[model samples]
Structures are given as structure tokens and as C-alpha cells.
Target: MTLYPATLLLHLVGVIGLFIALSLEVAVVSRLRVAKTTTQVHEWLTLSRVIDVLLPVSAVVILISGLVLTFSAWGWGHAWIELSLGLLVLLGLLGPVINGPRMKAIRVAAQAAPEGSISPALRQAIFHPVLRVYVPIPGLVALGAVIMMVLKLDWL
Candidate 1:
């Protein structure tokens, strides 16, 4: 196969991996929000560890493959390309700046609480206002990037 098609396939695979990681994060956080017991909280938090690994790996794959595709086939002049790269950076930052610390706090709270029902502190940590606002941003940004890529939007 040609370099362009091979890189395109890799880029698509990366996107699929990214979506899977993001979906798992959402599901785990949703479960953590409703967890009645510390055990359940711990369980869900353990599951989130998968996201910690998957998100970065997928993102790296996406970035490398996307850059290759851009340089090889698409060039850097398209408005959609620029915006999509910006969105990818934003998605990268959101995980570390917003989601990571908040989830760490929730895990800490879960660890400190007893094995019974969830504590107020744990509940608050799980349902942080920031997290509530931040949860949908990644998915929405990713969706927008996908749309732009598919449409080859050229509103530059």
C-alpha cells in the first residue's frame, strides 16, 4: 500500500482508540457518581486507571499519525486541519488539567472513607462542579474534529 493510505488507516485507528478511551472515561465517571458504597467507588476508580493509560496512548497515536497524514497528503493550509489540531491540543490539556486532578481527589476521598456507604466528601469529589462542566467537552471537541475532517471544511 501507498504511504498515504497506510497513514490514513493508522490515523483512523487512532481515532477509534481515542473514542474508546473517551467513552470508557465517561462511563466510569458516571458509575462513580452513583456509587453507593466505597467499594463501588474504588472499583470504578480502578477501572479509570485504564483510561489513564489508554487516553495518552491513543492521543499520541492520533497526533503522530495525523501529523504524518497532514504533511504527506493534506498539507497545513486547511482551516479544518488547523482547528482540528487545536481541538486535539485542548483535548490533551483537559485530561491533565481538569480531569486528572479531580479524579485523583475522588480516588483519595474514596480511599479514606469507610467500606460502607459513600461519604459526603467522596460524593462531593465525585460530583465536582468542574467535572460536571468538563465531562462533555472532550467528546464534543472530538466530534467537531471528526466532522471537520470528514467535510474537509475550508472556511479559512
Candidate 2:
């Protein structure tokens, strides 16, 4: 019956969008392990077009909406909010420096290889340590944030 409910709904949408992007990254890249043929690599890389826009846009929306929810109704001092905001900062960093570069490396390799010359090293780069670690970080943090919201834990 008030702005809180609407804002809450929007916030949920952003969360869903953010998770969807992360999930897709995991799914598509996992599939890459079995992927063969340069054309197939190109197709897999094409999946990025969907993710590239979804992640940042959803992140921005979440950040803006969270600020609104924080200042308007949820007090800034709440333990859960502070922790969630801290997780958000970590989330913001993960996409750009960690995941983004891994994806770009894959893209560059996919583009650089001669036609039909998809190599094992190229695939290894795609499944690099950074990406393996990076993929789950967002989802795990989001789940942690959700747990804090549900439990409403106190600041420690």
C-alpha cells in the first residue's frame, strides 16, 4: 500500500537479474569444456552479448534501488544492510576486474585463432583459475546477502 512494497519489488527484480547473469556465465562456460570447432567457440562467445548488458545494467539498478531503500525506509545503521552493502561493493569489483577480463581473454582467443584452429590452450584459458573462482563468487555472495536479510543478524 506504500512505496516500500514497490521498491521492494524492484529490488527483487534486480537481484533476479543479477543472479540470472551469473548463472548463465556458469552454464555457458561449463558447456565450453565440451565445445569443439571454432564456429562453436564463436557461438559460445556470442553468449556474452546477452551477459555483457545484463550484468552491469542489473547491478546499477540494484545499487540505485538499494540506496533508495536504505535511505528512505531501512535505516543506514542496520547490521544486515551494512553487510549487504559491503557485499555489494565486493560484487561490483568482481565483475569488472575478475570475471570481465577472463571473458575478454576467451573472446580474444576465440577471435585470434585461425579458422577451425581452436586449441587446447585457448580452452584452458577460458577455464582459467580466475574464472573458475570468479564464477561462483557472485552467486555465493548473493546467497549470503539473502541469508543475512532473512536472519537479520546483528553486526559483529
Candidate 3:
């Protein structure tokens, strides 16, 4: 009935959407890592495009709703809100800076490779060490933000 509850619902929806996108990305990356053929890689890459849409939409929803909530009910001084915002920024940066280019490279390699077993370059692109290390970071950061939000942690 009120703005706060409505905005909170929207924020929760955004969080759910974000996790859905992230989970899909995890699945796609896992599949890509072991994909045996160019067809498999291409299929998974197509699925990843769904994430390209979901992640940004969810993020924008979260940000706008969260800002409304912050200004209305929570104020700007809470440590948890600030930390959560920082985590959101980190997630925003990580996707474009780390995952975007790597996934693009994999897509490019998959497109160029002949229709057959995965090529050496495609394998290398899929299993890049940096991507492997980076995959869990966003999930962990999101989890931390959720924890802070729930607990309203203020130990700053």
C-alpha cells in the first residue's frame, strides 16, 4: 500500500533476478568449460546472451528501487546500505571488466572454429585461469551484500 513496502518488494525482485542471472552464468560457464564441440559452445553462448539481458535489467531495477528505499526509509548514513552499494558497484565492474571480454573471446573463437571438437584456442579461452578465479567472486560479493542487508550490519 505504501511506497516503502512496494519499493522493498521491487528490490527483492531485483535481487532474485540477479541471482537467477548469476546462477545461469555459472551453469553456462561450467558447460563451456567441458564443452566437447563447437556446437555445444555455441549453444551455451546463446544461453549466456540471456544473462546479458537479465543482469543489467536486474541491476537497474535493484539500483533504482534501492535508491528509493534508501532515501525514503533507511537514510544515507547506514553502513550496510553503503557497503551494499559498494558491492553492487563491484559486481557492475566485474561483469564488464572481467567476464565480458572473456566471454566475448570464447564466442569469437567458437564462431571461427570449424564445426567439430573444440579447438585448442577455444579450450584455452573457455578455461582461462582468470575467469575460473573470477567466477566465484561476484557470487560471494552478492551473498555478502545480502547478508549485510538482512543483518543491517553497521560495524563501520
- Could you say which candidate leads in TM-score? 3
- CA deviation > 4 Å runs, candidate 1: none
Which residues of candidate 3, in runs, are more than 4 Å off? Answer: none
Model 1 agreement with the true structure over 66-138: per-residue lDDT tens digits: 8998898889889888898988988797678888899989988988998899999999999899987888779
Q: Rate the local accuracy (lDDT) of all candidates.
A: 0.88, 0.82, 0.91
Model 2 Cα displacement at 4 (Å)?
0.8
What is candidate 2's lDDT per residue for 1-156, written digit by digit as tens? 688888888888988998998888888788766677778878877887888889888888888888899889978778888988888888888678887777888888887777776786677777698787778778888889989988988776
Best candidate (score: lDDT): 3
lDDT for position 13 in model 1: 90
Residue-pair clash count for candidate 2: 0
**How far is 119's C-alpha from truth in model 2 (Å)?**
1.9
Clashes of 1: 0
User: What TM-score, computed on C-alpha atoms, does each candidate reach?
Assistant: 0.96, 0.91, 0.97
Model 3 agreement with the true structure over 33-52: per-residue lDDT tens digits = 98899999999999999999
Deviation from native of the Cα of residue 114 in model 1, angstroms? 1.2
Worst window of 10 by summed lDDT in candidate 2 = 112-121
Error of 1 at 135 (Å): 0.9
